[model samples]
Target: MPENGRTDTGPTAEPMIRLEQLTKRYPGQDRPAVDRLDLDVPPGEIVVLLGPSGCGKTTTMKLINRLIEPTSGTILLDGEDVTRADPDALRRRIGYAIQQTGLFPHRSVADNVATVPRMLGWDRKRVAGRVDELLTLVGLDPDTYRGRLPRQLSGGQQQRVGVARALGADPEVMLMDEPFGAIDPLTRETLQNEFLRIQSELGKTIVFVTHDIDEAVKMGDRIAIFNAGSGIEQYDTPERILTEPATPFVSEFVGSGAAIKRLTLSRVGDVPVPDWPSIGQDTHRDERAAAVRAGAREFLPLLDADRRPLGWVPADASGDVLDRGLPIVTRIGPGDSLFAALDAMLAANSSAVVVVDDAGAYRGVLDLETILSTVHTDAGPAVPRPGTVATPGTV
Candidate 1:
């Protein structure tokens, strides 16, 4: 709760990155790009710098890596004073990814990802292994993409390569400046989710820069909302920022859709999944029909022998259920956000979405009503209905 927005990580644990009175001034500029600002980034947590253009959010991030030298201030990395450290050596310890991807057009994907490792004097075998490891880590197949140039890949692929390159040496800290900004919305969302999944495994200390509020909400463990002159208007969790605006600028910037934005904070797993009428694929035609009729549901969810959803069969379907009705095209996992669940429902034009586990096993069904009830209520776990047991996978 400190004004500087330092996360409380106990007395013994120091911040991974700390900026004290950080200031940067450009030549011929009347005002400093970054004023005397202070912030702290805890280990293994993402701290987002969010603001409008020219608000100095990017400048503050650049100053940390010495991409833009601070005119006056202190930069500390893992309790070491690195303000005057060798820029090259300092950068090698911190990964950097930017909006444009910045991959060499002629360089093969493997070579691009191996940049830092090669520079650090890693042997061919070591560098090669690292390249393949990171490429796979970022969802690119090393065997296929190793020899392909940046131009050979799609925009999303290029961005993935860029990320792989940034993580070339397995740095403990990563600085991402609008890394997904240039991609299309769908691809951007995918990359965001992928990166978040990666972060969960790697647990790297990250400084993420973005002008988009929704991205900040989704990606940031803590967001530092900046104003002109690099002044931090508010620094808090996304839930706090949305529910309790510290200032008028914060309120206006968050806009009037705060309720809708809160959906990003709750994951599908956190909500109670209600039981729906389901029939196994092996069921006989007469039994299936009887079950659907007795259940009185409009659609019957058909599950394979492994309890994995195959599709939904309409109530009036005849003969083989597998041959009829709509395929389960859109599905959500427990890790997905409620907003994503809602999106899946709308995209599939269905009233409910099939919930699957990590192994694609059927968990339960999430309907529109459950989502709305969560939104209007206190955001706690929903009450399980009578006769329905609430397992880890269900309400």
Candidate 2:
């Protein structure tokens, strides 16, 4: 396997997976575990189903893979109805990882990963190659770990093997139930960070279930907070869930630390763009010199014919417009969280990066100072007056 493909192109509207008024009821339970749940998991996104215990989050996830059939409604994958898709066929195409790391006790790690391919009737050599490739992809050394049985490995290592096994068939959609939950706190965080990095590269459409709000906030591209019989309380960015909770239940569930959590969600878009001066790319050298003499800053932002951001060019790099060429640009999408904007900035090694629409064209540079101010602003206090007296402990 060459690892999952990456798309650096702009966002696409096609929903990789969709649930339309999906409902699930168990025999003994009086209420539906998941009630009329409607959600869309856009291509290459991580959507977290978050809630407290017995909130129907797990049920919602299981329904997608058809491990538990829905009582009513439809489930669509890539716009095709999968409500009645064959269980074995559906299961093979959708990767699944649970908190238990359900490895077969009798099998070696390599053989375990080869389970699906073997079931699909792949020959010995292809299965072996796939097992080795998957193991390496999940950060496990194939040579050392491949021959070991599940019992011979540590819990974290076992979990890694479980992840490798799920990805064995190169499934487009992944269903994970607290894949990092059972580990110790430090190990959990390490796994979470590693998963984030992995996801960035793999671009799999992931549906993750978790009871931990912090984990949901940290891991999700968008989060759906459920309220059991009450249905979905909120489905939005982690930042929106923190900054503007949909209900009291959401606020209480997200808890007292939301303001600080907002730091992780708030990005360059939260702040207003400044009215900084700029010139067209075709300006003459005499005009450019005059603009510089008149206090034009270095590294001016460039724009296309539509006033869409292209990138920035250094003032000293070239005096001629044609010589500047197309400016190198990096940007965060409008749908991205503040944290993503920060990551973009750091990756670009610039204090600011361009913000763009769902399409790849530029919006504007979201500077670091703008981000910091949004994070540090008081929760309820009005902007401070120059002569006002300060309260004892309020902003």
Candidate 3:
């Protein structure tokens, strides 16, 4: 388990999964689909294998699930060698989700989800209760969708049911191969958000495969970019890959809109804010006027002794003494993504938002001017500053 209590002790001493010198060769193929791939997936992180089709991403995923045997090397699950384990036994302990969803056409939704539990010889009452519980957990009403067949639900709903089926036994690790690829854009985004929520609560170590760069960026804690024949080209945090592509192939794969993508991952704290003058409640009107004369702006952020924000103080006020609620105050946290700050600013009708720390203490403000200027600067790369960790619920 991790120190923060965000991970599980089930796989504490060893990686949730590890592929050491793994490779795969088709019957008559000249080269292996995957080449000596070595990777580690921590207990609560989602590691995405991203590359073009036939780049061995899918082949690598199947090898983990035992759907495809590795031509060479070993696969360890929670420190035990899976290569020698019974295929059914190994699969029962790992959740698997794929593009087609693979729900049984003849079985009711609830019964389909209950397949694993039934196959494992769970009690009748236990299977029924788990079916209902999982149905609700995946956003399907037990009374409404449980009795229906797989053909009865929408494509997106079917995908959700597929996820529910994979999670039936509460497997510690998940293997998702383009699970959202068959759905529409809006549905895909919805599923992605729901998956993120579920992963947070469940703390499953997930290995996700995708060819889309955007999906890779959005859904991965760390991305593994492969170059088909070259093995794993680069494996790093999404921020690092977007900011500093490990190779020319990686840079080209990420494309030209990388800057725009960075904005979504970068937080307000990553950009430097210009110093602005602020007035206190105790300042006299004449003195406030003097400070205003020194600076062009009339409004400033008022902070408490701990550098926590109180509110914005407007210059040329009527009195020297001020009370709480004298200034307008509404802000987002410093850890929020830049997109969130932008949204807050839009909704508040303000140019900036006072950035607060985890304790709600104000740190600084983020404005359009600051964000735009930073984007325009000759900054080498938009590396997430030290001290920033993945947001607890984010992939």
Candidate 4:
């Protein structure tokens, strides 16, 4: 590992982005905003520049796309020196999104999304098709939202449109500067999930900037925790940053409650799914009662004919099991993080939550006890590092 904790992938694998002694100093300023920094961002991964306010994370992002000229140093994109490339051309190849959304007030959503393709001189037919495709990709209905102005949309909607616009020409790389920071908490979370889904599909190389540690942990494949002068305190995966802080600054900046934060690193699918007693919604009363008596569970999961969970039924209850059972207000999928499973349980005030597949078919069950056990396992809370040996009792 490099002194900054950044893994060197060696000469055979060229990074999508490489910064060698990159520095940005402004006139009349005593110190440089971004001190000489060396960093590498592999292709098809999200590398987050995380730090406190004014730590130059944003500046580093801007430097990547030449939004601001660097005082001196090399900026390589796909092994080509782009430090002195045409600013406009370089930016066109890099998608950029900021906290403000930055959509044109006078333009319609479709028109805004078409900005890059239009600039690239794509014909109207192709541009229009790309706009519609991108709108739908970002969860906006083209027919309903295409003609609407930026002012007419909600904050979350505007951000979605902004993202659509950033991806206008299908750039290989994207720069996001706290894109969801201005939205409401619930909406912010929804957008974050949506973006992650999109990234999984597109696999775009991304450099995301944020001061929020939780956001960094959730979004980044690797995080560069910056201190003042753009110094990288720790450049490693979120699991390592939380489990093994490189410096006192990183430990303090990561803050307390690391055990809880580690939960985000694991997904529901990573844990063993426990089988729970279940009954079909249409089972006869006698049959249901007999099955309940046969099992030791107090409550049995109720499933529809299609095998999707409906609710939980008290095993001893009489009459129709479906009508008397408690409704399942929340259901999670394999892709959801264990943190999300825990949240679902807490939000529904239940000790267990239903797990489903992509088609919403019943998979198994995740209970509070399983989550606790996973957290307190001998292997330590989070997943083991790539090459590290686990202890004898470790999971």
Candidate 5:
């Protein structure tokens, strides 16, 4: 594997991929396609290159694998200089997926995915096993689709095959150029989500090129906005880029609704959901009476034996227990975007949404006021239940 390790990155302590003073100019062109570009892609992170057409984003990507030779500069993968390495060999070490997919109509899906592994001289059993494994990884049913030709699959399926093929060799880095751009919006979103789930699991160092801001925001750990000279207009997280754009060009490119885009960065886990007044299902009558009289809550959350909330008991209702205030239907988990929580609230026409853990155990209630307070200031911590109000933690 070419002694891939960086002392700075533990045993592998340097940038997974580094481009320094990279420049590319066509023979007769007045300007370089990528002029003196410099970029460092750290291991286990997705760095998105986003810009307008003709802004050198794709050129910069191609330079890394030497798909197009740089006019002058250096390419380093895992800290070893690759400027002098064989282009084809360097490329094989880096997985590349493109918008067109480039699958072979003549080849079956499994064979297409096996391309890289086969080239690497794996035994037939290993190549076949890897092909099936990769096909399954990208959500294709190997048993059903393995032998099917690429033309027989739908566009989305073809794209999946492209991704699986790219991953067949399990390369440390992936270069994806608008790989989802051709799919319909709904399918595109589904594929994007699936990619995210896969990326989170695989943690491959990736350079994703896209012209769409929303897709960049959704996919990138850090986004680099490029200019004609390959200069970075802004390089930061989606939150900083949206909330505090570095330049007018960026603000314009990010488009309107900075506030709405901010919602994407804010997760339900990060909002401050205040503790509510609650009583156990077997609480004493006097205790229940005191809770209703105190009026600290609109409804006392009723807890079961396991500390999970049953339903709301209206504070104004008579007796220890009354008719269920409302069924606990929709819930927002920690990983969900605040935008989703707000949507759930609006859909239910409720002031607050229930937050729950993965097991469906109630955590707390997130209200509009708390969400606004945190988001408007842009300083909220994740799932802060302030004021030490003694929450049951499971409701």
Candidate 6:
């Protein structure tokens, strides 16, 4: 056994599921659906198979679940040869979710979720309990949603049921083919977030196929990019692919706004936040004036007695010290996405945003210039210089 929770004995550790010289061809087709594919998905990892349509990403996923028999090559699942296993028994142990949901209209939500467990000869009580548990796992309240038919629910709800059903048997391996593709953008994003949260705890070895580069970047721990004829162009993490494309084809496929996409992955608390002059609301007018004069950005953040951010006032503008600055309706917290910060800035029509802690204490500020600068440089937080313009990037 490896020590300190590490695997060893060689430089390379065996993957949970490995595809060796995997290929697929259809009769009368001009080319193979999947060609000479070699990929490794480690346990407790998500490997997104990303490419344009007809790239054979779906075919690769289908091969794993035995929906499509591979023309050649072997599939090793936990070092076991699945090619010789019974397809029916093999599929029961592997969960599958797809774009259309594929829920049975005649079956209730609970029944749909209970399909695999029942097929596996689980007791009726056990299947029912597992159905409720899986539904709750996917954020559906079994008491409310269990009896509803597929058509009674909205598209998003149906997709949730589909996910719950796929996870019904507690499978260690999951295959998802654009499970959120049919839903609207907002719902799709919500599902993606919820799914990621589930994956974080469950740690299922997942093969997710998608044509959307943004989805791949958001969902993948590592991504495999497929080219024409189902050939893998590159296989690497999202960070590497975004900052360093392996080839011209990858650069083109990722499209423009790659940098902005990286911002979505960043959190406000990941980088060091700078400090600026702040005056307690209870402070005397003269002290407030002094703080304003010492402010870094054009505005000074007013804090309460506890140093919690209240609002802002122009550093140079004169006003009643007791009277607060412009009312800030929106605030960004440490957990907020940088993309969210940019959106908040655009919505507020402000050049800079005040950063605050959970207790509303002033942390720092963010602006376009700061975000742009951080993207280019690897420098740490800047020390405050009185009367200096502050740009908090990536903080």
Of the candidates shown, which would achieve the greatest TM-score relative to the real structure?
A: 6
lDDT of 2 by residue, 1-395 (tens): 00101122214687898888888877998877777777888888888888888887888889999999999989899899989989889889899999999999999999899988898899999999999998887778999999999999988888889888888888899999999989998777656766776777688899999999888987887888877553777787676678778788889999997965665544344457554555455666566545644654555566566656554655554544434433554666654556666777788787776666655555666777777777776552222111121111111
Name the lDDT of candidate 3: 0.76
| Per-residue C-alpha lDDT of model 3 across residues 130-158, encoded as one tens digit per residue | 99998998899999999999999999999
TM-score of each: 0.84, 0.67, 0.74, 0.87, 0.84, 0.89
Which segments of candidate 2 are over 4 A away from where they belong? 1-12, 265-372, 377-395
Cα displacement (angstroms), candidate 4, residue 89, comes to 1.5
Where in model 3 is the C-alpha error above 4 Å? Answer: 1-13, 267-336, 340-365, 373-395
Instruction: Let me know the TM-score candidate 2 reaches against the reference structure.
Output: 0.67
Tell me the whole-model lDDT of each prediction, alpha carbons only.
Answer: 0.84, 0.74, 0.76, 0.84, 0.78, 0.79
Q: What C-alpha RMSD separates each model from the true structure?
A: 5.3, 13.0, 7.2, 5.6, 6.4, 6.8
lDDT of 5 at 140: 92
Candidate 1 lDDT by residue in tens digits, 1-395: 32354544322467899999888988998988888888988888888899899898998899999999999989999999999999999999999999999999989999999999999999999999999999999999899999999999999999999999999999999999999999999899778877877887788999999999999988888899987657898888787788878888888888888877887677788898877878888887777777777885678888889988888877777765535456887878876678778888999898899988878888889999998998888644542211122122222
Model 1 residue runs over 4 Å out of place are: 1-3, 7-12, 275-304, 310-329, 379-395
TM-score of decoy 6? 0.89
Which whole-number lDDT from 0 to 100 does residue 160 have in model 4? Answer: 99
By TM-score, the better pick of 1 and 6 is 6
Candidates 4 and 6, the one with greater TM-score: 6
RMSD of 5: 6.4
- lDDT, candidate 4, 44-91, per-residue tens: 888999999999999999999988899999999989999988989999
State model 6's lDDT: 0.79
Q: Write down the lDDT that model 4 would get.
A: 0.84
**Candidate 2, residue 285: how far the Cα is off, in Å:** 43
